[model samples]
Target chain A: MNHSVRAVDRIAPRRQGNWDWRAAGNFVAGGAGGGVLACVAALSIGLGFDPRLLLAVGLAMMGFGLTCVWFEIGRPWRAMNVFRHVGSSWMTREAYVALFAMGTGLLAIGLGTRPLVAATGLLGLLFIYAQARILAANKGIPAWRHGRCLPVVLSTGLAEGAGLVACAGAWAAWWRYPAMLLVPLCAWRVIAWRRYLAALAADGAPVGTLTAFRRINSLFVWGGNLVPVVLAGVAVLADAPILAVLAGMLTVAAGWQMKYSLVCRAAFTQGFALPKQPVRGNSRTGPGVKPGWQWNRWLTD
Target chain B: MKRYAMVIDLRRCVGCQTCTAACKSANATPTGVQWRRVLDLESGEFPDVRRSFVPVACMHCANPPCEEVCPTTATKKRADGLVTIDYDICIGCANCIMACPYDARSIIHQPQYAYGDQPIASEAARMDSQHIGVATKCTFCKDRIDLAERTGQIPGRDPEVTPACVNSCISGAMHFGDILDSDSNVSRLLAENESFRMHEELGTAPAVHYILDRR
Candidate 1:
């Protein structure tokens, strides 16, 4: 146990800081990006999907999202009780919205009702937005503190929703309209990525450590932001559904990477100056012994 | 409608983690898990050395981010401003964990148990253990509050029902009361001291306040 403790103590410490904006930005990107992919997949299955099936899928996604949340929490079983604070807790509000949205989506599917689906879809969009807003509310995280993040996330949701609708349209051979929506959504994604990148480049560096900031810029700014932009452009030009879907997939991966970089890298360090060096004796000594020098040497110097 | 809040004077908080230990025991938090934590924050350098102990727990904010990101409506706040979790409905989702800025929440994926002789029945222990995989946080001892209220002893008004952390504070640095009440000890202290929240800029309207060491 002592040896293990010593070993653990020897491990190098990493930088600690807040990367709220970056995390929020990436979350927006993921929700919007993943939403688009899901929409595309739904469309590809044909708009005639059984309302039940659609509801099931949507609910499943919500459940999966919940699992992610639970995994991140300190106590999973206690999570249910959080809803008790729905009136005051943003978490409760988000949870209620998610549950309501899933239920609505499920009901619409079960009834094969267009109005219900639309309502559910709208609620779903809001659910995603609520997730974004939750992160954006944290001003301590500079990356997530901007007004633009909320709008950007909302737009991403729209784009992704449109893409899903388009996939359904494609299967139904009703491609023209959904494609029109996808074009703008893809464009918005590009613009948002650019803006996020610019912000990160300008302010990514935390107060003290240069290494962590550089890592953030290189990993997130380049890998997450740049790669996705290039891939998205190629997909747009290809004008192929497969290409678009592939680009969307890459975008999600990049977004996750961005999130990881933000979480692992951002930190705050206390600043301090080094102490002055002490004067040394003039006389040289053996490796094992202290140096001995005459007092006269100090006087002469 | 009780409004519970904690005031921590950073000056006298020795970071002994007694409050943390007391919170864990009161809450029965698992080993290697902490309901309250003390952070050792060092600033400046060498001759200008400054070290501060930051003891943290759930802020029980007026607007909690964890509540906003839950998809299953599992996490909630009480009328008394205590943020709590319901184990039964939780789907093991970690959305709230990502949403919290303070990292106050933890997801229990595995059951924890006492190693000594079983004082409580196995069934009861199993029932308690079933709360695994749900999000957990400091409840400000809601169970204690409930017990006290039932016995005609409301916390803040009665010393017996006060939170374990507040009662165990040796330096009188930890204060708990209603932030809404004008004459409450917490409010009076805030009025007299230069107080600040951990992340006031976030605007989550945290109820927990801090008084830093001016000296």
Candidate 2:
């Protein structure tokens, strides 16, 4: 009998169907869309921008996101069942919270009441938290299950929301407030993203995942975080509202890139792990190898 | 009150894949979908290489992650400790597929004949399998087990009622019985051997056990 031993990574197979780009789209649109609405409502109560226009844009973006996910399920007709398991499932909670958010958001826009707007904004934040929890609960994917995922997803939504409001702020000449918020928020995103990557590398995540993160990292840092920070700062220095507007747009793009790389490129399933190796003849038993990660020192390091 | 379980003796298994074939025949699973499979693991350096065959299927854990993550109450754990998927209610969102760390579940997309484009009737192509887009996995031959229980016959001991893979094991490496029962074959095997479950650290508490070869 031929006893040829193949490489470990080539032998073991990875799992399938955790989530795809479509799901990522759902998170991005849902979180950022709700965030924009919430921020706009906040600005309306403070700066007196048109709540109707901001509320409309926010609702449209959120609906678009939900529709994208509606097409992704295997059984679309029974999609309402997502609300059935609220006790244990985060996805169910997200569905219920989303409904609550829309109801309050509409009331806040109609009545222009501070209490209504506060309730809407609070529920909007909860909605984003629920989205983060949905990914965190997936223990099968190492990258998604990481503790940092909660913060990363949450911050991305915040940045995206602030960015949208900043863009609108330029037109309304209220750009200073959101542009100021964008600098610190974008700075936080940059730092948090770096820490997240370091943690993944230290934990020995798959080389493919790390590489994807590195590729997407540059875009988010330079364009999403750093560029926006620069633009917002320049706007403050030069007293130019256009620079602040550009910063907001860049922040939104960065948030999109973050979710895309996470859900599509870096999202690998946690495959099989065998505790003990099988014995042959009188040879000593050895530990089973984990196959998904790359082992080359130079490439991994 | 009956908790069914399985034990595999690695020493007697020769990787013949008779059990794999038996399962496919009994269940009529669609193309590319395997309810039972034998994974061939080869390790060690040259001239002193080692080859081992591990038969892997659904663990049917005591605390099943699939049931916890399912948005619909489709994936359910029965009183007898068997995990079953209810197809009619399943939205096929693939949530349970991701939650199962064992990679035991498969989302069946389109029905295909064993023979390419033959338009033949595959018996496994009906019921849960018939649904074009739904999650499918091993049921531990629930129909046979149900029949045996109703007739007051013990499973595992009765070849006519045990899991198809366990009954087809040529080397008698596979054992199926109630681990909760003190007199059951699986309980006795567990007591007498050095055994381990796959991914035990995940706190899944799998019902399946493996006995390493005592060389």
Candidate 3:
């Protein structure tokens, strides 16, 4: 029995400072851009309008997101080194996928090739998935690493993309065609967000993160999800492209805001924890401790 | 076959912070940064309370998330299970910082001098330019271990070959050795005590083991 006396307390979840607005920008711009490209591949038939403008916009958004990442990194000159670890790194895969997506989109725009459009669109979706993987791979971050984050981020991107395209470019005549996608994708985004919130609570998160998310619940559900969806419905029913454009803008804005919250506001590091507490007595233990994370699994353990 | 590991005896550790200072002196880290840290963990109630000092650093995990997520291939795991980062190759994307569950990795954007903008002679001489703008952390005192191993001196037995933190621990609570060797100090300590690795649920297979009991 050899132990000395020492007092101890708990450590709360620490907010990560490595990634900021620049990181969120990648997810927002890249996701919306990818979504737009996917829409072009899936819903571009019989729309009586040329997609050259859409292609240019999607490529431009992707470039903007990539530049954000470029600025965020400390060693901007060595960014090309990102390609060296494609075998295990999702970021490397993202870079490669982005390059392919960019090339195919440019070629599709330049040559007006149908197969190239589909290829570029598929690559864009892959890029979004890769971005999701990048967030999920960070085990230190509880909010981003959740399994539900995949569906949430993916659905948001698709919704944002469709929303932007639905209200733009000769939309007065063909609003119904794009609205068909905008409404459904917006609804799906809502469902995904709901599941993500549910899982975060059920699966357990830092108390601060949970609070931050709860604070934005009304804004996210009403302003982002419900309101935009209702607006989209009114636009289609009333044959009003202007209302549809408003709804689309709302959908895109909401998605960006949500991503910003996830990456910056609620991105808390899984702080230190001890599974067992050692007492100042003969080789005996007390209780386990995980600061800030209070959940069934941890409490029960 | 060798796997480097550290065994920290929670019962013995008093949180003196000598190891932390020793590590800083040996590594010459910036003022705000600490590669080695001792976390003060308290649990239980007021009447029946329990507190312990947790000395933590880079675990050099068998399945290192940092190594897996490094986009530049700068982070690598040696055959002997020593996870290392190549400062020259690292682009400082901070992917490794996010991936590491232990919060062991850090990316310093600029060099900080102990005294104002002017560098004291020791600070200027000890400053590592390559470490700037890259992810850095404790390497189990890799330089000392490698140098000792190259000269055919055993790491665990030789004080010069061991980590600065382990050598500096006042309580003798920290032990470093090859866990692969059955008779090694670290393996023996683990076998004779009830030990647990931090974040074992994450499957990082962290090399740092905390002993909760004595033989």
TM-score of each: 0.61, 0.91, 0.95
Error of 1 at B21 (Å): 1.1
| Quality of candidate 2 docking, DockQ | 0.50
lDDT of 3 by residue, A1-301 (tens): 1122232422457788999899889999988898888886666645545677887888889889989999999899989999999889999999999999989999999987778888988987898899999999998888888999998899889888888887684245677767667777878888888888788888888876776777777788888878888888887889777877888888889899999999899888887777777545555787777777644332232
lDDT tens digits by residue: candidate 3, B66-173:
988999999999987789999889999999999988889888888988789888999888998888888999988989888876887777778989889999989889
Classified by CAPRI criteria, candidate 1 counts as incorrect
TM-score of 1: 0.61
Q: What local distance difference test score does each model get?
A: 0.55, 0.78, 0.84
TM-score of chain A of each: 0.60, 0.91, 0.92
In the range B55-144, model 1's lDDT, one tens digit per residue, is 777788888877766656677778888888777676555556555656576666665445543434543443356456666788887887
Best by DockQ: 3
The lDDT-based order of candidates, best leading, equals 3, 2, 1
TM-score of 2: 0.91
Q: Candidates' DockQ values?
A: 0.12, 0.50, 0.57
lDDT of 2 at A52: 73
Highest-scoring model, TM-score: 3
How should the candidates be ordered by TM-score, best one leading? Answer: 3, 2, 1
Best by lDDT: 3
All candidates' chain B TM-scores are 0.88, 0.94, 0.96
Tell me candidate 1's TM-score on chain B. Answer: 0.88
Tell me the spans in candidate 3 whose CA falls farther than 4 Å from its real position.
Answer: A1-10, A46-48, A170-172, A281-283, A296-301
